[model samples]
Target: MTTFKKSFLILMLPLMAFTAAHKFYLSVTHVGYSEKDDALQITTRLFIDDMEKLLDERYGLKAQLGTDVESKSADEYLEKYFRTKLLFEIDGQPAEYQFLGKKYDTDMLICYFEIPKIGMDKIKSIQIQNEILTDLFDEQQNVVHFKIKEKKKSFVLIKSDTKGMLNL
Candidate 1:
């Protein structure tokens, strides 16, 4: 694991809210088409406190994210949230991404996903809609980076422009 992944062991609390002076809400999602695995691997990094707040508001469950006292149903809520907030497509066909799991480092929650059995050779155009955290924070921005073969591209997604298509 990378040092960033190891940072989850260091517990830290998040700011209750962003002030006018600090108004950026962001998440980074990395998607790579793995030739060896014949799958698209995804890792999304989000603030643990933000996710917990959403969970509490939606399911009335307080998820301690990286802590030992984290709710058992936390994963369930994550699954539901991602399914509703994110979507991926290969070419023009809808691609189904399976939620692998999640981990926490510091105040960030990293969620994992995989599009199984998807061959890299079959991709020409890709589409993505990532609305994570937009419901809570008006300024929430979801950044998606995709890599396939030797080509790579990225997108900045916001509430109004949550969906984007890339031609390779």
Candidate 2:
């Protein structure tokens, strides 16, 4: 109950609160070309809580992703959001991908996409633009991994630089 002790406690309370409130925002995406299927497969992993917040904030809907009471239009909004935020270009031509579906993995939401009929011989380079969760989180980072045959490349994309190119 001393004055010095009370002052120190007050000063430390804000610092403790700030430290506890800090969180890291990150997402991981994998893009691989399948020789057998002659297609490009993409998978993105995002934190379920972060994505739920984004769905609510961006679309004014309580998506409640991964929960029993999830919104019915969640998938539609997810596809719409991702279609605008994430993009790809193969050999300098815009590549359109089909949003296959999404699944929940523990604390993450994994989304599946595919660009069919993409032959290995036709791909000289690939450009990726991933802006997932960047608008909602200023410190968001999107880590992308590309695997084409035996070659592999990785990039860490942020709000400022959301695009990367990999050349074979």
Candidate 3:
């Protein structure tokens, strides 16, 4: 084969492989909410593109940056949308995830409750886990805060808080 033809085939092969892999990843991800436990529980994955579009549609604001925009503006917009939209649920029930009552040095989102009553004694323990992308501007800041709860004598147990990092 000619040199030019061989080089062209090699480059196109890798590019086609990359595109296929990306397509597979997107298909694996969940876009809308999924009902579990007979509609008592729901699990959903929020994509960055969906988040940006939702913010624009709901609040008439854009969180993501433009092709040729300032970084500071983009950061500020994303932070605001994240702070507003990130949430958690247990057994298909909504629970408070953002701490509205504390001032912190960093841009940390806190979800509290020494113990939240979800209307069932059968629930011996409840675990709230969240995966959020860290802020681009503040490397030290996290999108979620998991606070430790002290031991108390009760049939209902509220376990320790667990924090996680989400890579987008």
Best by lDDT: 2
TM-score versus the correct structure, for each prediction: 0.85, 0.93, 0.26
Q: After superposition, which runs of candidate 2 have C-alpha atoms over 4 Å from their true positions? A: 1-4
lDDT, each prediction:
0.87, 0.94, 0.34
Estimate, for each residue in 7-112, the C-alpha lDDT of model 2 and write its tens digit: 9999999888867766889999999988888999999999999999998898998998999999999999999999999999999999999999999989999999
Please give the ranking of all candidate structures by TM-score, highest first, separated by commas. Answer: 2, 1, 3
lDDT of 3 by residue, 1-168 (tens): 999999999989978886664311010111111122111121222344543444566566655533344234544554465444344444444455322221112222222212233343233333334323322111222223222223222111112222332221
Off by over 4 Å in 3: 1-7, 10-54, 57-60, 64-94, 97-123, 127-168
Positional deviation of 61 in candidate 3, in angstroms?
Answer: 2.1
Which candidate should be chosen as best, given TM-score against the real structure? 2
**C-alpha positional error of residue 140 in candidate 1 after TM-score superposition, expressed in Å:** 0.2
Following a full C-alpha superposition, what root-mean-square deviation does model 1 have from the true structure? 11.9
True-structure lDDT of candidate 3: 0.34
Could you tell me which residue pairs clash in candidate 3?
A: none
Question: What TM-score should be assigned to candidate 1?
Answer: 0.85
Count clashing pairs, candidate 2.
Answer: 0
How far in Å is the alpha carbon of 50 misplaced in model 2? 1.0
| Superposition-based RMSD of candidate 2 using all C-alpha atoms, in angstroms | 1.5
Summarize candidate 1's per-residue lDDT along 93-127 as a digit string, tens digits. 98999999988788899999999997677678888
